[model samples]
Target: MSKNLVEVRGLKKYFPLGDGNILKAVDDVSFTIREGETFGLVGESGCGKTTVGRTITRLYTATDGQILFDGKDVTHLNKKDSKALAKDMQMIFQDPYASLDPRMTVEMIISEGMKIHKMYSEEETRNRVYELLELVGLNKEHATRYPHEFSGGQRQRVGIARALAVNPRFIVCDEPISALDVSVQAQVVNLLKKLQKEKHLSYLFIAHDLSLVKYLSDRIGVMYMGSLVEVTEAEELYKNPLHPYTRALLSAIPVADPKEENERHRIVLSGEPSNPINTLAECKFYSRCPHKAECCKAGLPALREVKKGHFLACSNADALYVDNQGFL
Candidate 1:
């Protein structure tokens, strides 16, 4: 087995409101991404998936918990070490247009990281910029153009090129294809897969699209409210989802075949997601879970392995099984 390139343990990022309330954007989340593997994080909007990615890249400081990168304790890196960490870790933002500076040329945007890290000389940086652009499917001539000149797909290619500039070992892909057209989304996903194979890069991919996540991820983690509810291999997750939220999510993925799609039962979950502000120690999905038992209300279940290579946080698996038989 490949060694873990990144390990996040009990990670938490809480935002303080003006009042006494505290919003737990990420609460006690933990996972590991092996070298050259893609770990996909999926959930509904406002589920703290984005916050986990940002915190891992150090764009946002953590409220508590530890982050280890390549066996180094990176949770509290000094200035010098932090600068070194920048070269090893990188992020691709969701908004391709907003992430790239309008005033800068494509060449400038792609070579910025290399120049900051002093990775190459000026001539080398320029040559590397052209190479990266080509690697991401853009040509050398486009380097002189500004962000406004490119289409959404082209702009996203530029963003991908920029992320690759430093030759990072790991990247946080924060919904890199969410804003693109359906045709373009596949192209970007393929590009990422191609790059990962060529460069041996690990990814922490965060997205709401479950089908896309399954296609690209080696393993998957399902998040809800502020915590991870289930984690397992990508295929195993779709084949056997133990958590109620996971079942609901998988059931909602649109089937490609019209006949099958029409025939399949959809698990329509009711009620809004629970508020994250100072929530009590109880199952957050209690409001919408059809399998909820009195035991679920006692305290928040800690994520533990239920079977080989599968981890779950739900305590009422029997109840889930009972409901699965006829609840759909």
Candidate 2:
């Protein structure tokens, strides 16, 4: 079996509002991404998916919990060690245009990480930048152009190249394709898949798009109100989702066939997602879950394996599963 490349245990990140309140962006989330596997994280906007990615990548420090990257504790690494760790893990930000420095050329942007890490000589770095540009579907000639000169998709390609320039083993892709046009989204996803296969890279793929997440992920994790409520293999998640949130999310995906689309019942979740500030010890999804019971409000349910490899955090998961029958 492939070893876990990243292990996040009880990871929590909270921001103080200074009025005796805290925004719990990520609260007690735990999961593992195996070497060379894509672990998809899906949820609605403001659900802490991006915060999870950023915290794992060390862009934001964890308020609590452990982050083990390739067996090393990254939650409190020294500056030198942290700088060294950068070569092993990199992030592809959600917004390509905002992530890239507008003043810098593509070549410079791609080479910056390598220069910081001292991966190669000046001559080799230039060659590596050219190679990276081509690797991400951009040509060597395009490397000299500024970010403003390219379209959104092309700029994202540049962003991908910059992340790859460091030759990292793991990447946190923070909704990398969300901002691109629909026509270009698939192309970027394909490129990412191709690169993953060729480079043997592990990805923490975060997005709100269920269809895309299902397509590219080896395993899928459903997050709601800053907590992971369900996690299982990609196929298992679609085939037998136990959590109400997961089922609701899957139901929202539009079927391409008209007949199937018309026949399917959409599970529209009621109420906005629960507030994450100083959350109570109840199911984070309690307000939105149709299967809510008195037991659900007793306390926060611990994530437990209901079946082999399928984990759920609902108090009445088994009951919900039985009740759903053919629906889920």
Candidate 3:
């Protein structure tokens, strides 16, 4: 079995909205990413996908639970340890334009991490920056220009170079390609895959696009409200989705064959998601799940293995099935 590079156990992040109200962003989520593998996370907007990434990278202090990086608990590291930990973990933000500083040139942006970590001499750092520029499909000439001078895809490349400067083992990619043009997204994703193979890196790739996630992930986890409803191998997830929410999500994907597309039936979820503030001890997706039972409202369902290597959190998984007519 491959060793897990990162392990998140019962992770929770709650933001205080003031007026004695707390917004439950990530609640009791757990998963493991193996070394050199990509673990994809998918959900609708405001479903706490980004929050999970931020909390795991220690950008936001987790409200509860444990985060273990290479067998070391880092949920609350000290200043010295946190600084040292930076060399092994990094993040690629969703918005390239907003993440990069307009005033700084690409060279400066990429070398800042090296300078902070005191990795190499000035001459060596400059040479490394040039190498990284070339590695990400940009020339050394582009390094002298500011972020505004590059296109959206080029800016994202620069972001990738910056993350690679310190030679990280794991990265949290928070929708890194969502802001780019449809044509450019594939190029960026291909570059990331190449880099992962070359560097033996692990990634927690968060995105709302299910097709893209399926293409890049070794395993996929589906989130609803603030909790994970299903997790399994990428191919297994598409072939056999047990949770009602997972079935609904997969039903929305468009097929290429005209005949199949016309015959497909979409599962329309009724009612808005329940509020996340001070939520009760009940299933978060109970209101919207098509196969919801009275027992679902009694308490929260624990994630359990429903089949070999496939985990699900639902009280009525046994009764749910997909037939020729559709989900029933």
Candidate 4:
């Protein structure tokens, strides 16, 4: 098995509402991203998927728990240490347009990391910027242009180049393709795959699109209201989703075959969503889970392995209790 490049244990990120309330962004989330593997995190908006990625890359200070990167505890690093850590870990923001500074040209944006870490001299940095531009499918001529000159897809490629500038081993892809057009999404995804294979990079790919996640991820983690409900190998997750939220998420993916689409049963969840503000120590999906029982309110269901390599968090222990035509 490949060694883990990133290990997040019992990670928590809470934001204060200033009214004696706390917004539990990430609550005790734990997972690992192996070297050269893509760990996809899929969830509805406000489920804390982005926060988890940010916390892992040290963009956000973790409220609690440990973040281990390459066997070192990086949960809380000082400014100097954090700057050093940046070369090993980086992030590709969701919005390519907003992520890049309009005042700077593409060359400046891509070479910023190299300059920050003083990884190379000015001449070497310029050559590296041109090299990275070509690596990301852009030309050397475009280096002088600003971000606004390119389309969404082109700008995203620039973002990818920027992330790779420092030769990071692990990257947090915070919905990198969500803002792009449908036609261009595939191009960006393919570029990422190529880069991963060439560089042996690990990724924590956070997204709301289950289909895209399925296509790109080695393992998939389903998050619900600041907690992971199901985790398994990509194909295995689609083949057998143990958690109710996972099933619902899988069912929501539109099918290409009209017959299969028509016949497939959709798991429409009922009931109000659980409040994230200082939530009780219980299942977050309890409010909207169709398979939820009275026993679900007893206590928080910790994420535990049900079968080999397949983990789930549900109070209902009956593994055979699959619904909606065995989740189609």
| Predicted structure with the largest lDDT when compared to the true one | 1
Candidate 2 lDDT tens digits, 194-306: 99999999999999999899999999999987889999999999888888888888898898899999998899998888778856876778777798898998866878988
Give the worst 10-residue stretch by lDDT in candidate 2: 319-328
Give the distance in Å from residue 205's predicted Cα in candidate 3 to where it truly belongs.
0.3
Cα lDDT of candidate 2 equals: 0.90
Give the per-residue lDDT of model 1 (tens digit) for 19-129: 988999999999999999999999999999999999999988999999999988898878999999999999998999899999999999999999999999999999999
lDDT of 3 by residue, 1-328 (tens): 7899999999999999978899999989999999999999999888899999999989999999999999999999999999999899999999999999999999999999999999999999999999999999999999899999989999999999999999999999999999999899999999999999999999999999898999999999999878998999999888877788878788877877899998989898897778888577768887787877878887668789877788988876665552232333
lDDT of 4: 0.90
How many clashing pairs per prediction, in order?
A: 0, 0, 0, 0
Query: Residue 324 CA error for candidate 4 (Å)?
Result: 15
Q: Could you tell me how far off, in angstroms, the CA of residue 81 lies in candidate 4 after the best superposition?
A: 1.1
- Writing each residue's lDDT as its tens digit, candidate 4 over 167-209 gives 9999999999999999999999999999999999998899999
- TM-score for predicted model 2 compared with the true structure: 0.97
Off by over 4 Å in 2: 322-327
Residue runs of model 1 more than 4 Å from their true location after superposition: 322-328
* Sequence-dependent TM-score of model 1: 0.97
Count backbone overlaps in model 1. 0
Show pairs that collide, candidate 3.
none
lDDT of each: 0.92, 0.90, 0.91, 0.90
lDDT at 226, model 2: 84
